[model samples]
Target: MHFDGSTWWMFYDGTSRGRRHVGLATSADGRSFTRHPRNPLVLDAGAVDVQRVGGVWVMLRESGTGTLWSTSPDGLCWVDRGRLFGLSGASTDRFGQVTPHLQVVDGVPSAIWFGGASVVSWNRNRIAVAYPDGAPAPAGSGCTACVSAGLSCAAACQSALGATGGACGMPGSTDGSRCCACAPEGCERCIGASADCHAACVSAGAAGGWCATPGSTDGSRCCACW
Candidate 1:
């Protein structure tokens, strides 16, 4: 029901064709759709468009398997960027689709998604949302810590288990100047500081102060964030 970059168009997918694909129809007006010569522009094939990058155009499809993206110049042919993100490496859930709801936030393309836990999101060329194993904390402000922990996080502050000095603030914020980690006093929270927070830690793989696990923190500790 959304318009193509120019003309009006309708998009549908993943049910009738026995494959995941995008069906397109043109309209002289915003209503009254007419199937275009190039109907079903995209098909189910394991590419970003087929089941990644969200509802064929929105930018937030979460298959629970992982987040993937497909790049295209004309919404015609697409290439797989491959697992743009996931909840946890140990995850096995598959909501069966990645709906990338891309939007410009402060003049930048940011993808919006809805699915399982550990689904983190960041903005740049486009907002990248994902988790590791399709576990908890997939979306929401906590994503920063969840993704930093490679999606194994159950809310850093909450995980502190109420220890006097263990728990911290919530996730989200702090990137490209965006805020991330919630202040220790439970005051302010970061909006896009997923990476910097990890980078500021003593080391990426350490068990103290913001570090999550190996391969998730620094290249020396965690996998070093893809």
Candidate 2:
């Protein structure tokens, strides 16, 4: 909850039809409150945190899949800024981040969230941090072959592995000729395979495919087939 001089605003989560939503309420005396006409300001969002940053309002929420960020000029109308962070591709946080909180330390803004290895296992999770600029990339980020082919780390992972998104394992990573990390889906990772990736896919009964990570003689590579 925050106060804008005269009106106190509160953002909360509510469930309707088995789905979570973000709601807004306002109070004049910090006691009696009224719900905004747009009660559920956002759909499929929960665990909201709103704060005044510089001259605008920043809102962070967990969308189950990942954490999302938004900004508002008056705290009433919000503009989504997309996913707060990308998958690190680590066994600890391979899925995504959730339950986000925005904190400013030494004049630098950062996002804190919880990441778990699996979607259902929360007992053994890790707290992760992400900055406005970016976060540190994880180890073995993505296919080295794809990165060598002049693709952004994230793009390499996404296009090569057919993943939802990707992240790099290092800072100041450029778009071309840099390796990143990605969670593979609808793809197969081959270790110590020297055969042609496309032929291997065809041999495996795929209609057509490409070597997501090519040019590896004795290492892990991936084959993406359609």
Q: Number of the top candidate by lDDT?
A: 2
- Candidate 2 stretches greater than 4 Å from native: 105-108, 115-124, 134-226
- The digit string of per-residue lDDT tens for model 2 on 1-226 reads 8887999999988887888888899999999999999667777777788877778888887644567788989777888898866665544355556667788555456545454333333333455555455454333333543364323454455446555446676545544444465643322346224223544555666554556764443323466665
Per-model TM against the reference: 0.42, 0.52
- Steric clash count of candidate 1: 64
Worst 10 residues of 1 by lDDT: 118-127
Please report the TM-score between candidate 2 and the true structure: 0.52
lDDT of each: 0.40, 0.61
Candidate 1 Cα deviation (angstroms), residue 61: 4.0
Query: How does candidate 2 score on lDDT?
Result: 0.61
